[model samples]
Target chain A: MEEKLSVNHLLGIKNINQNDIKLIFKTADNFKTVINRSIKRVPSLRDITVANIFFENSTRTRVSFELAEKRLSADIVNFSSTSSSVSKGETLIDTVNNILAMKVDMVVMRHPAPGAAVFLAKNTNTQVINAGDGTHEHPTQALLDAYSIKEKLGDVKGKKIAIIGDILHSRVAISNILCLKKLGAEVMVCGPATLIPKYIGSMGVKIEYNLQNALKWCDVANMLRIQLERQDIKYFPSLREYTMQYGINLQTLQNLEKEIVIMHPGPINRGVEITSDVADHNQSIILNQVENGVAIRMAVLYLLAMKKTENVKN
Target chain B: MKKRILLDSNHTKIMLRRIAMQISETHGNLDNCAIIGMQPRGIKLAKKLLELLTEITKNKKIEYGELDSTFYRDDFRKGDKFLIPNSLNIDFLIENKIIILVDDVLYTGRSVRSALNSLGDFGRPLKIELVTLVDRKFNRELPIQPDYVGEEVDSRAKDIVEVIWAEENSSPEVWIITDK
Candidate 1:
């Protein structure tokens, strides 16, 4: 049973197959058990070194990747563009190549430009894990989200998952849609017309305008954070009006006859994307998503490290 | 390529009864003792041993656990094949209890070494005893040996000694194959 992932680099959720997703989930299951133990570190990647290269500002994603690397017992090097030679106009390839000079085995990268991780994978020989690239795809986030869904609901198949709030500027939304769809879940993207992407319909997901209607029809609702930093022009007239139209609150959940699982990729915009009460609701799996993030990232790194044995195979 | 029967099902059952009696004689009533099966293949041997142990000592029973040592193995990235892990189901505590670590074959002594390392996670055991269906002699890479063995065979390191214990294809038997 040589159950390995199809792709070498975790560029995005779009680049991996269904079996790759399943393999990742299966590996994550073991790591999940390890993390809950008295001693939470594994010696699987003891000889490997991973560098986290972030060309953008982040809190949760950066910390999650770092913690995942640490838990695997892998030596890690963290680089943020604001503090590195990147601020002095050093190219991505040159910066990464310099780190590679130090014998780094793998890279977990988040860049402001889309396809930056893809370009890095092409130029470098080491395995590249896309932490996040622009608003393209956060594959690990999507993976952890699906894993959490499976953990909560027993399975991801035949589940109706509604992705609410800003869809156009979320890598998490794209990755989640691709992952959930691959796992045989029904996905529906909901938001204001301006905040939603025009190309979303091509992804084979249902589009809905009414928040209450979408909520009533789905088994899970994943609320996305509005990327105000990436927004140049006004997508909506006012935050207050957008909250009134798209935000999920305790009332929205209570009005439904069936309870729905609530999820958020963190650094949540409290009253804007989801109210405090709903975010902390009993049915909310927001915290479980955070813990699963480490396990999922560990699985990705460990599987990719398994590829290194193949490097010496020939 | 070749095949040989070291022990048939009838002999295997009788050998299991003898080993179960030995275990009962060593630790009478099985108090403060537990049975642990190394995962992937040792689980089958462990299950059979537990059934026989229960039959012989009807009043005493031991908790059974499946331990996977893939993560603790010294050869993580050093091997040609990737280590695929099996599920660990050691729910009961092994603290201060005797653990009879069971496996199908004892070769290289590496798996047993890693298994000993893995047993540390589920609390410290008072002692650990090794049990095996076959022990490949004169091919040891580490200073380790099984306490209880059904049979010991001497063969070339390059040759293969396979134990086909039914279910998948043939009946319960062991084979030693050499390249032509």
Candidate 2:
């Protein structure tokens, strides 16, 4: 099989087809083995350097990408919005170009503005990976989520996935829907009426406002983080009200007809989006998702680096 | 294109069986020996050898695994062609065990080098041995040799040696193709 990935940079899941996703998952499979080994490091990208350029606050994605870079034996330079010259009113392109002048091979970026990665990709010669661009897309997160689903359920095709909560501002939800749908899985969005986008149903996803129906219908329920930081106006009544109607608790999970996998894109709102009991349930693969994030990011970096080197050879 | 049969199905089976016997002779009872097939083509050969060894010795205690050397290769991202990685499915620890690395062809010895690096990531082996079905003599870029070879074939740079297996083809045949 030819390893030529369809895209140079994973800007969004929207541009990738089933083959590309499968290829990433396949590459992730090898990386998953690498991480589980005793040495847990490969010199595949020994000379290559990666930059984790985060213009927004992050814990898992930043740390995961750094760890992936380290595990691949790639040189890493981390840039954060607070510490970088962007705090001194330096523009995005100027900052990235300045970093590129230092010989960075790729940039894994998360910015607060939507299309931030796309903008940087257009402006820079270095490869741009969209870690999270506002609520636009976090392609790696989506890939890891899909990979985790495939891991837990043995496959993703023909499986029912309900992405619950904060659909309006959840990049994880958007990316997961596209990824799951691309992999032949049925995806439905479940959130409050105000929180769910009006035309999200047009994207071939069934919209369910009720939590019980969503949980009952899905083989996996991915509860997205409610973006309190991104919200300018109140989208829901209160945390208590949202938790009462939409939160995934032990009682709600026990009431379901069959067992379903629980997922969260983390820094969970605890009692708000999911209760502690259900989050700690053996069925919840939140930590597995985080662990797979490292492998998935490694796969992404490794494949993109291969393409870059192949292009250089050409 | 002119094709010459280096080994037919019968010859291939005999060679594999002889190699299995040779392995059993070296490490009797085969308890601590782990057979790792370098992936894609090597895996098929390793699986066949493991089956034969198990049947001949009636010892099903030998550990067998497949190791993909794509990520461990030095030419991984340096080539014009995109490199697709194969499966690495080793479940047991290779620590302090006699490791037999199996591959179908030994041309440049780079693949075996990568396999050694990959095996290092797993665990330290007590002793490592190389087993190749077709040992292309005089084509090595590195100082690596197979401990067990099925057939030592001398071929030019333009010649292509291929192992046609029933797993991927209609019949098993080793063909040497030359442009005439």
How does model 2 fare in lDDT? 0.90
Task: Tell the DockQ for candidate 2.
Answer: 0.76
* Residue pairs in collision within model 1: none
Candidate of highest DockQ = 2
> What's the lDDT for residue A137 in model 2?
92
- Against the true structure, what is every candidate's RMSD? 1.8, 1.9
Candidate 1 CAPRI grade: medium
How many pairs of residues in model 2 come into backbone collision? 0
Among these predicted structures, which one has the highest lDDT? 2
Model 1 chain B: weakest 10-residue lDDT segment is B166-175
